[model samples]
Target chain A: MYQTIGEEIQVAGLFKKGRFWPSKFKWSGQTFNIQKITLTAEANNGGVKLRYYSVLASGNLYRLQYNRQFETWRLMEIWCEG
Target chain B: MKGEVGLTGLNHCLSDYKDCWAHVDINSYFATLIQQENPALRGQPVGIVKESGRTCIIAASKEAKLLGVSTGSRKDEALLLAPNIRLIPAQFDFYLDATRRLKRLFESLSPEVQIFSLDEAFINLTSCKYLYRDTHTFGTLVQTKIKQELGEWVTANVGISWNRFLAKIAGETGPKGSITSINQENLDYKLATTKFTDVSGVGYRLEKRLKAIGIENLYQIKLFSNQELEKHLGPFWSKQLRKMSFGEEPNLFEHIDSNPHMKSVGRSITGYKLCNNETEIKQILYNLVLETASKARSMGLAGRQISVYLSGEGRYWFSHVTLPSYVNQNKEVFELVYHYLYKKWQRSFLVIKFGVRLSLLKPETQINQPLWPTWHKQRYLEKAVDELAQKYGLFTVRPASLLNGQLIRPEVTGFLGDKSFQLGS
Candidate 1:
């Protein structure tokens, strides 16, 4: 099941190959270790360019958004596997 | 006929900016998007449903399609066919965002781009076609660009042709990663082999109608007189078929269209279960009204005609009427529909599906400014609400009556009926 969780989160990753690769994220007082970055896309959020990474962490899916203008990270949404 | 068409088509294409157009179609759109997001689902049979607990599979991944679990199959049937298949809910917002970025990339590559749908677009490469050497090379470069910029696993097919019709036909015929082209030289041969239904806009119903009249081949349609085809297929389609046969764009995207207007703004929903409750029905109707009106307002459009439709197990209800004044506000459109349309449907009808459409569209400016200051205040309030909705979400602020019920999510239509609404946003 998937649920909307649009909250600012702390994220750590490497900016490699001209793109950011998020490897870990902290949301709702819990840490999720990223397993793989399955898909990526960039979109304009109210004139701010934000790159999105749909990552798999602990067998669950999370959409990690990084705002380029503000230099902030947000956990946009999540899909949990039962 | 070929000689005449070749000469005229050459001249038309030479001067048309849409000359050497390329149709870019994402492969197995929804399924692939899901697979691209989840690592465990990659290389596995995947089916995308509208949401959890929904049974019908709207899309199937390449693996699932290869396994014979067809689209529109029940979840149970899909399990039987591919037991290990994963089912994911449709993520229309994600799809739209990705599509927007893809369109931006296409726009960067070409001067003119037409956003056809969430998964497809037509790129005009006439001015820059020479830069990539040939159509095939250009297509390959686009595929590479998609992989490099979008995602490594996500891929798209490129179809190049002289016109929109031929380009779309070429795009739909090839394999997921293949680059196909149709031009004047191969146009006749392609038409001879392509099925009537395979051509865009020719659905099964039209195919059955054509078959009823013994017209089997797309190329052979030219052999029949216009009167004979019109007698059976109606004049609009008869003309359309002739245009398709010649690979001519019938309308709209012939020029570089950035702000194409919509003929209508509509929203419809099919519930997961049959709903017989009046309150639930009203909520659904309200949701539909809110969406259609919001779309109209955002585009600075208003409609004088409102159509409401509903379907039960054995009955269908429809109402279409014109209002004295054009309306683009959600509350105004909702009141008209609720009073004239929904209220008339029998309470016990057991609605399985419902829809509302706002047509006879004109610019909001077409309506005269009302004499009341309250009306102007209401319009300003609505504009503020719309701006907030655009920034946050569609349902960021909604009626209290919809507080308990599940909010119906507004999706970007796959056919792109409202081009400016989806593409501009």
Candidate 2:
């Protein structure tokens, strides 16, 4: 239900000492629960790799690709399923 | 085939026996008037409305008629048929003033003047034979006067015939901005081909009925025996229908009424972003009341019923209130509307247009003076304000409360109450 035509963003707890610094978290003086996310493929070419898996937002379309070796994702070459 | 040709010109001894009559019908009078006033509207499908609403089209130009749009057609229906049709609101007061001014021009040409409506009229040129050498010369003079006094944009189709019906038909079929006639010659040919509905007496509904009965042409209806027509259409209607078919005259006396009265006084303003504030709304109401009341005073009459209408932005939330007592006072009308506005509208920002109407009125003398001090004082204050406004001008003096920013003022709401509204006795 959280899926959109472009970018999908997510945040989760990473600390184990009963405390953790939230990355890419929107703070409104309150905590929010994470939900399932999905993104649409780029308009053309192969999926671009990202340091963190993130989908292309708007304007020129590009897909999200992840690198298993670096434990990160980056938008690499432009790719589209269609 | 038995049409008379040049009889009037040849037989001067029996000119009185002939008694030539003529009518000048303005093609699409209201729409054409607007087009003549604004050149941009020329050659477009124009529809005029008595009030801006979904309900009715008061008049339509020739261009509009071709699209199956007509007078009294619902605006929504007209729009569906011709989306690009131009819509114009009826300015009765403007037309009335122009009618009066044009009548003066007609009076100069002929002693007998009969105003058919705000847009059309007939002048009896029978008594004024000495004014011009021929009927054509006289028509040209009348045409010149109208063009000179009223704008050149306005045109009339002049019909010089023996009687009113033939003249009316002549004017209806004539070319734009010129004089034409249905004379002894070609009368049958004109009537034969013309649609029954296009004739003045037979409307669309009757035309449809006539066609269903295998009477598609006016000539066929004319050929039917009186007893045969009477058997199908009954006595009174058959008589009238037979007149239309035979090119005979109808009962013109019953049709013509002389005294014209203003039915209602109203004012509307556009371009006010729909407003939610109470004070601003009241100011618009006040201005409308002031204008209406002043018109009442000018016409020597007062309104007993006051109507207030507010249209929400883009055709949502439309409501109207009609008050019972005739009021020509601004304060009285505004106070009534104030209560309605306060009750219905939340202080939300969404009002685009507003209007006030005073109707079901009698003469100013008929304004009842109640024994209550508040009512009497309010009435007096209103009378004073209306008087002052007439002498000086609108907004020359107004309540301080009405100066608030929430009030909507439209560009068309020129200081002159000369066009948008008028009071009727």
Candidate 3:
């Protein structure tokens, strides 16, 4: 069970804008900050599928991937990006 | 075909120096070396166990690994999986010797060598272009020489790329006991197939998270725009991972440290038994200050920041104070930390661990010209203390406060910059 309220959390996680920024952040929220996150591929029947996720935070979870050909972030799962 | 990634949690893109880097890691080097030295162990199940009362296998041979015995598994659990498994205690000295020999070999190959650890190094092979046909040939020769001269005891997975970040990834997912050049040749294919953990900088925790996200391979991480990764993962991890994907290196450490100025110097003791009294705790902290201060004196360095940590009852308390001026004298650090700890701690009898940390370190730049006669006397006394400790052993003089039976503590190897105390050879 997670109760998100009135907690001061500081995270040394990376925050990406266009590239990478070393984020030393302090945020007051109801949840633990981004504890862990990763970008990897899903091996499927057809081909490789790109994926993304946040392991620590819960509220704003999204599933968008980078399409090299289109050169854009494509949303695969609606709730993943939210 | 993947090689050993060596240690975990390597941040790839944080380098500040060069563009290209080479990470030549031994492929299951310890286990492989052990097996290779004894041919019978080859093709047999073997695991490297740490020296402990109970067996904790750190690395397993590929064959043993196939039998489902691997790193971090208890010997009992491994035996349950493979009853015929051969367990060997970690030969850290041998591994250290091998690592030093390998480092010497690397130095001969190139003047610039970053010895990351026993089994891994970041080599700047940029200037040695004419010496070898190419990076591939150079990597091959390195691998061959290690195998031939080092008693065929180990094999290396060499990653040659434009940066340490990419070079690490290349070495990690490259062929076993071979080299992989992540350039125009096989970057895409490599990214597409390699497991997320197989990437150089990624770890088990990150891999699990990535897999949960439905992204389980390297190509997907490469596919994400740096912006999206930052927004989702935050700046630090996003930047590091992006660098890993792009094969970028972050030269975080300054290569030149002729007069290496330390950022921090401190000692920590993992308590076997908690100190019961405040006096005992203070004594332990003072001892650490003395030991660390001796080191500072040895190196002619001083620090402005003094920090302390106390852990007990599933909680940790940390406090730090900066001095007005740089001071490496043990008294100053001890006094500062003692005050900080006194204010923050409960003075309860349930303390389990004590640690002292010193930071904001710098060389003693200013010459002493004391205005007060007392101050001049103190300066001379401090110099005498420093000289005595340098000439004799470190603990030749001890503060009277620490004489109470409470302050004497157990030995902690590697506490005072003793490299010999390292667990990983």
Candidate 4:
């Protein structure tokens, strides 16, 4: 199942080789430790570029979106596996 | 005499069946993508609309389809049918991204993949047959790879056949998430039962004509001679139909070129809002001309004939103009459109859709210098503008009139081809 949660979150990651790699993020009183990056795609929202990451954390997949113009992060989706 | 063989000859041809092409068609493409994006929406009554709670449904999920809500259904009607139905606005960028990922998967299997649409592709697996023992094995591999790589929700129905047309039919008629093959053995039986209209090229007009001549099924098409079919349908169409009916590859299909020259290129825009005035119509026409011209220019081709069409409230109007020289510039095409609109300027009905078509195309390298001095200057200026637009982006440079106009931004498009994501955007 996937849930839509458009909530701003604090992301702690390193910017290596001009790309942001998220190591972890705190969202809704819970911390998700990133394990691997599955897919990365870019989208343009109202002329502002946003980088979306489909990452695997704790054996579950989550969609994290980072706004380039606003310099903020938001948790977009969570794919929970049973 | 040998080429004129009938049922017996067709049966003999079955012994030489060879799997060459595989058509992969995504199920309920846009709706499936929406469901895949949000698993919560899966197996639910979902209708994808251009706008939430406003526009008609552009695509309906299988759940909504089961409830008799389909594309072009009004939002009110959909709500009445299924009150709990979810209407999601279309996200074209995400759909295009999924298409790209699917294309990559197809490429991993075969190098000769032709994207028929954003959700369908024809891959020639003739050269890669040695890698897999049979077509069924190869088809299974494709389905498994897509599910594992893209998503388990992203399923496809694949059809394997000797030609593109048969493969397409098999894909459409086959069970969802399964592989079906239409070879020479079952070609005659399939054609006997399949209606002529079910075939791709046979539209309503053609179906009516075929029915008038007592041609109802695909088998009837095989009985007609090429000359007889030509008299009924046009020469080119008759030849294609004959080839398809006989299970013989057309010349174009046999010698499939990587980049074939297009006979015509066109695009149509159907907006949710209505255009009630001439100025508004012209603004939309200008935007369409820009798109058509950009597409032609991108293909390194120029057209000598331009056609403009406007439709609203069951009324349709069209005008065609022929230019002295081949041109692929927005200003030139817009001038032709303006001339037509000036003569037929009637704000009677609210315009819902407008389109522009460019035909009689020739290679851009064959263009000759115009005699008029102003045209010469205009050509150079347009060339520089096109170069900048290609490099930076289409919206980087635009006409001053479009600055205030509420025109939709044109995306990267191909002539008679699928919409692809622009690189470096």
Candidate 5:
């Protein structure tokens, strides 16, 4: 099952070697620990840069997007394993 | 005939049962791709259209298909068939990117992989038989890899046979996420049951022709003798159908390495917002020229003949001009197209579609120097700009005029209609 969660979230992570790696995030008043970052990609739109990540947390896959221009983070999607 | 006794001749016959060609076709490619990206859409009825305003459905998901919605169905028909169907516009960039990912997966399995279309491919797995016990195992492995790498929702039907045509038929006939094979032993039975229209190259026109000749199935093709077929159809088509009936591969498949010289390069834009004036139309033509020239240059070819066309309100206008020397620069092509349009300028109904075609192509290496030496400087400068565009992006450096006009982004498409992946914005 997949659901769209276009919500802003609080992320606690470390910026190591010029890369931001998220360990956990609080969304919808619930905290979840990310197990791994499966994929990373960058998208540019009219000079605004956005970094996207497909991460695994609590046996579910979640898509996280970081807007470098606005300095905001969004939880775009969630894939719940059935 | 005496000179054709080599690998070329061997490829035409099913001499080695161990060697096979595999055709992999994505099930409801566009619809499945959308589902793969958006998990919420999984198992839900969906239809993909050209755009929001467009009514025709280009693809329908399996769920939608169950409700009698299918490709080519109108929006009204689809909605009537499945009231809950979700309609999404086609995203060419996302589909192209997915195709590239599929190609990479196929290439890892076999060195000889030909992309048949945006969503289909043929792989030669003759050398890899030893690695897998049978074709079924090999097909399963390929499917598993695609699911693991691309997405869990992406599935394909694989067909294995001694030749490409039969492999394609097998794939089409098989259920999704399964592998089917047609061999020498089962070829005749399969053909006997299959409809003529179901075959690869047979279309409605050919099907009607075959029906007139009392032929309704693939097996019935053998009922007519070559002379009889030649009398009814032409000699070329007669021979093609006869060969297809026996499951013989065409000669062109043998010499696939030889690239045919491109006779023309063209691009057309349709279903876009109608342009209101000549200036807007010229702007669109300029963008088309840029794309056409880039395509010609990519193939290391240049064209001397240029043609422009505008069609709308059930009317069309076309004009062509042959240049003194072959050219593949954006400026040269744009100027020629603009001049032709300028000469034929007339206020007409809104221009809904337009095209630019460059013909009389010759290898860039074979082109002769122009009479004026200054042209050489322009050519060198264009080459440098092309390199930069190729590296950074196509839109990185473009004509200043294009900024004011609406331009359709040129998609990276292959000669065979395969599109390059457009990643990263």
Candidate 6:
């Protein structure tokens, strides 16, 4: 199942090879460690360009968005296996 | 018809390609991305539909394909083929984003690259071929970099040749994750072994046409003159076939990339379920107008001709009108479509699908006009609304009419028409 959850969250990551690699994130009073980043892409909402990282953790997929202009992180969506 | 042939201008026979181009085709792009994101789906049959309850599959996993569940297969047919096939909604944004990343990697490898579609790209290796020992070395470099930068599960086939035509064919010939190269030395052999249908432009009907003319392979076209081919095919195809017979990339084939000016901007949708209410149907039409107009506006294009289509319940309503002036804003296009399309439908039962198109487009930059007071006021109002949309989100502020029913969220098409709007939305 897929869920659209646009909630602001806290993310911790490492800067490697001139790119920010998100290692973990906190959402909904729980912490999920990112096992791997499957893909990263930049999208523009109106004029605000944001970067999204698709990460796998805890047997689920998370789409995390980062707006560089505001220095904020938003949890965009999640895919959970049933 | 002359200029319509496409870029690199004139057509002539060219010599063999010595590692001049590389075509990278991401195998089962949408399905692979899904598998990459969710490991549980890696070994299973997967079908990607537009949304829940949507019957048609836009893409299928290699497993599903092997089971005869190809793209365009209905959900019912897919289940018949693979009972346990997992049907997932397509994540267009994710797929597009992945393509962008791949494009960046290709651009880094070579200064010139052609993104044919979401899953395919052609990189001009002419300038950089001197740095590599052979096409295999360069192909391996591309594969290794892809695994390192994208993900281990993401894989592609690489084809290297002198031009885009043969390179793409070579990529298609190889198994997944393999590199295939064709040159003058093996050109005839490759053409002899490959079916005409394997070529990009050749479809089932065209293949039948070729076979009807006693032509079975690409090499046979060379044996016949363009005049003889023209007797079977048209003037255009005869010329195109002559070039393709010699492993030449036809300029006409690159029309989309060569022509930046779009002829039309349109939007179509198949609703979750059929609706019969007049108000509900009108809401959908208005929604489509918003999408079409916004796309044209984003592309800085305005159209003088507008067309609309509605089909369902054993009835069809199609209409088109040439406006007094070109229009690109939502207000103008919506008002016109409402008058020319929706209001004109004498009767309605149910609407399963509908579409709106703006054609005869011209660049907004080319339109120079003296501003009238009313027009100036409307333009300012539109500018204000666009600012709000851009600052907040595309649908953050919508017309009050859209609130009458459930609003349809914006969706992008697989064929990346009006890319500015697709990528932005």
Give the clash count for each candidate: 0, 21, 27, 0, 0, 1
lDDT of 5 by residue, B1-425 (tens): 01222211111222245677889988888888777765557899999887656778888998998899988899999989999888877655556656767778888988878777778888988877555656666777888998886678889988888888888887787766777777766688778877775587777998898889898877788988989999988987798888888887655455433445667888887755666776777778888998888878877889999999888888877889988889888888888889755457575667788899999989888987677767778778877877776555566677788888555676543224313213211
Under CAPRI classification, how is model 2 graded? incorrect
lDDT tens per residue, model 3, B132-152: 655556776898888765656
Error of 1 at B335 (Å): 1.4
List model 2 lDDT by residue over B1-425, tens digit each: 12222322111211431566667666676776666654456688889875444346878987898899988787789999888887776544345555657667777777776666556667776776555555456556667777776566667777666677776776666556556556555678778867665577677777777776789877788678888888877797788877777777776534454334456767776532557766666666776666666666566566666666666755544445555556666666666666654357554446657777777767666566567888778767766765564454455567787665543322222122333221111
Clashing pairs in 1: none
Give the DockQ ranking, best first. 6, 1, 4, 5, 3, 2
Error of model 1, residue B29, in angstroms: 0.9
Query: Chain A alone, TM-score for each of the models?
Result: 0.89, 0.25, 0.31, 0.91, 0.90, 0.92
Q: What lDDT score is found at residue B15 in candidate 3?
A: 27
Write one digit per residue (lDDT tens) for candidate 1, span A1-82: 5677889999988989786788898988999999888777666543356688888888788988887876889888888665
Quick one: best TM-score, which candidate? 6
Off by over 4 Å in 2: A1-82, B1-20, B26-98, B150-155, B184-186, B196-198, B201-206, B209-257, B260-293, B303-327, B333-359, B366-368, B398-425
Q: Please identify which of the two predictions, 1 or 3, would achieve the higher TM-score against the true structure.
A: 1
Model 3, stretches more than 4 Å misplaced?
Answer: A1-82, B1-20, B27-101, B134-137, B144-152, B200-213, B225-227, B235-240, B250-260, B273-283, B347-353, B366-425
Instruction: Report how far residue B70 has shifted in candidate 6, in Å.
Output: 0.7
**Considering chain A alone, what is the TM-score of candidate 3?**
0.31
Clashing pairs in 5: none
Full-model lDDT for every candidate: 0.79, 0.58, 0.60, 0.73, 0.75, 0.80
Scored against the true structure, residue B232 in model 4 reaches a CA lDDT of 90
**Whose TM-score is higher: candidate 3's or candidate 4's?**
4
For residue B44, what is the lDDT in candidate 5? Answer: 93
Tens digit of per-residue lDDT, candidate 6, span B276-356: 787777788888898788778778889999998888888878999997778887887888888766788876567898899
Instruction: Kindly indicate the candidate among 4 and 6 with the higher TM-score.
Output: 6
Fnat (0 to 1) per candidate:
0.33, 0.00, 0.00, 0.05, 0.00, 0.60
Candidate 4 segments whose C-alpha is farther than 4 A from its true place:
A1-82, B1-19, B51-54, B193-198, B208-216, B219-246, B249-259, B339-343, B371-393, B411-425
> Which numbered prediction scores highest in DockQ against the true structure?
6
Ranked candidates (TM-score, high to low): 6, 1, 5, 4, 3, 2
Candidate 4, residues B7-123, lDDT tens digits: the string is: 211111222346577889887777877777655677889898764435688888878988989888998999899888888877566666666777788889887887766678889
DockQ of 4: 0.16
